[model samples]
Target: MQPTVQPFFESVTGTVTYVVFRSGHPECAVIDPVLNYDPKAGRTSTTDAHRVVEFVRQHGLQVQWILETHAHADHLSAAQYLRHELGGAVAIGQHIRTVQSVFKTLFNLERGFRVDGSQFDHLFREGEKFSIGALAAKALYVPGHTPADTAYQIGDAVFVGDTLFMPDVGTARCDFPGGNARALYDSIRKLLALPGDTRLFMCHDYPPDGRKPEWETTVLAQREHNIHVHDGITEAQFVRMRETRDATLAMPVLMLPSIQVNIRAGEFPPVEENGQSYLKIPLNAL
Candidate 1:
């Protein structure tokens, strides 16, 4: 059964959060939900998250899962908040433990932080099947945007987070820690290998030249038109282009803050002795 999906765009971070469910069914899953953040103020608010919550409530949807395609570096996750308000298991790829361990050292997080992928309610392995109401879903371990990126395949629609973007925009950057251009090319092949008509939903869209942001496209369109890796592009060609392009890019503005919070499934870092939660910014550590 094809799942019905609703997209909620958070423009500040250019993130697309999705609410997906089976037709005529109350059970649903929220994907990549965002929590609004004011970096200048060092504060987070749930206004964007509430919009999703409102939609679920208005539609009388039952949220069975709050899923993350990966630990995002562009925006804070609303998983914990949504799980609190909507009642669902917060889940991600089993490899999140790799992310947790890496960031645990990068951020020098307190000893209390666990690196076993225990922050999430469930850890999904590649090929694992689960149900969202009557809709059957499987997790595809499509890494390389980071070591933990995943794509959720629910029938014909695949929620590809930070994997492939719009045709003109190309694919995700591979310069982040643990990201590999070779691996990313292989992962994109896996995605493009899907049935030509399968719908591939993007997690973020950085529109160009007055174009409107889009979150959905087909496997065929990507194979034909994706500038970075079209049907004939070789693995060597993709890796070279990706590496060269990534070298010119800058680290995401919210990378530091987002990593810490996302590593904990969107929960803020523990309160400090000063009676306030703090996000550390390690000087000169990128």
Candidate 2:
């Protein structure tokens, strides 16, 4: 069955959150939900997440999974908040342990902090089969932008997380810790290998020129028009282009804060004796 997909665009971070479910079923999965953050104040709000909650409640849908495509750097995840409010298992790629370990050391997290991926209720393996109600789903390991990145295939639709953006925007940068441009190229090829009509949903979109934000495209469109990796683009060429482009890019504004929270499954760092949570910034450490 084709799942019904609803996208919510968070403009501040150019992140797109999706709610997917079967038409006649109540079970649904929420993917890459955003948690609002104000860097200046180190504050978090649920304005965006509430929109998801309202939609779910209005549709009488039960969230079966709160899924993370990867531990994102551009925006904080609303997985924890949505799980608390809607009651669902929070899940991510099983390899999130690698990402968690990297950030845990960088942030010098508390001694009790674990990097076993236990923070998430479920950890998906490559090609792992699961379901939201009767709608079938599978996890595809699409590491490039990050070691633990995953794209979820629900029926005929694939929620491609940061692997490919709109054709005009090209693709995601592979400059973060453990990111590999070659791996990204291979991953993109894997995605493009799907059926021509397969629907692809983006995790984020940065509209260029005056184009309005869009999050859905198809395998054929990308294979034909994707500026960076169109049909004739070789892996070597893509890697070189990716590395060159990544070198000129600045680190995302919310990288430090987002990583700390996301690695913990969207929960903030442990509160101090003063009852406050703090995110760290390691100077000169990129």
Candidate 3:
């Protein structure tokens, strides 16, 4: 069965949130939803997430899962928000504990903060099978953009999180902690090895040269035209290209705040006596 997919593009962060289900099926999954954040004012709004809520209601969908492709650094997640409003299990790759440990140490989070991925409702192992109504889905561990990155294979479509972008945009950078260029290359190969016509959905798009942002591509398109890792490009070549390009890139604007909130499953840190939650910025700690 080919599932129905509705995409909500958050232009500020160029993130794409998807609501996927089968036709005439009430159960669905929400993938990579974004929560609006204004770094300058340190305020968060649900304006973006509300769009997803509206869609679910309009379709009479029962959200079975709020899925995170990974602990995103470029934007805050709305998994918790969507779960609260729409009801679902919040899940991510089981390797998220590894990511949580690394960031916990770097940020010096509160002593009570656990790095065991307990914050999320469910942790998926590679190839684990689940269901979104009648649609069969599996989790693919594609960890290069981050140690915990996961891609969801639902029906004929795969939600590739930050692993490969539009063919013209190449692929994801691997300079972040726990990110491995070689592993990313291998992961991409695994994805490309899928049937050529398999649909691939991007979690984000950074369009260039005045083109409108696009979020869908095919395995054949990526295998043939992805600038950084087309068929003939070797693992060594991709590693070199990825490493060199990653060096020239700047840290994402919301990396600091996004990590803090994302690592906690989209909930703010516990409020202090003053009744305020704060995100820490460890100077010179990247």
lDDT of each: 0.94, 0.95, 0.95
Off by over 4 Å in 1: none
**Superposed Cα deviation of residue 286, candidate 2 (Å):** 1.2
The residue-by-residue lDDT of candidate 1 on 201-220, one tens digit each, is 99999999799989899999
Model 2 C-alpha lDDT per residue in residues 1-286, reported as the tens digit of each score: 6789999999999999999999989999999999999999999999999999999999999999999999999999998899989989999999999998998888889999999999999999999999999999999999999999999999999999989999999999999999999999999999999999999999999999899999999999999999999999999999999999999999999999999999899998889999988889899988
What is the overall TM-score of model 3 with all chains considered together? 0.99
The TM-score, computed over Cα atoms with residue i paired to residue i, of candidate 1 is 0.99
Poorest 10 consecutive residues by lDDT, candidate 2: 100-109
Q: What's the C-alpha lDDT at position 91 in model 2?
A: 95
lDDT per residue (tens digit) for residues 1-286 in model 3 = 6899999999999999999999998999999999999999999999999999999999899999999999999999998889889999999999999999999999999999999999999999999999998999999999999988999999999999999999999999999999999999999999999999999999999999899999999999999999999999999999999999999999999999999999888889999999999999999977
TM-score of each: 0.99, 0.99, 0.99
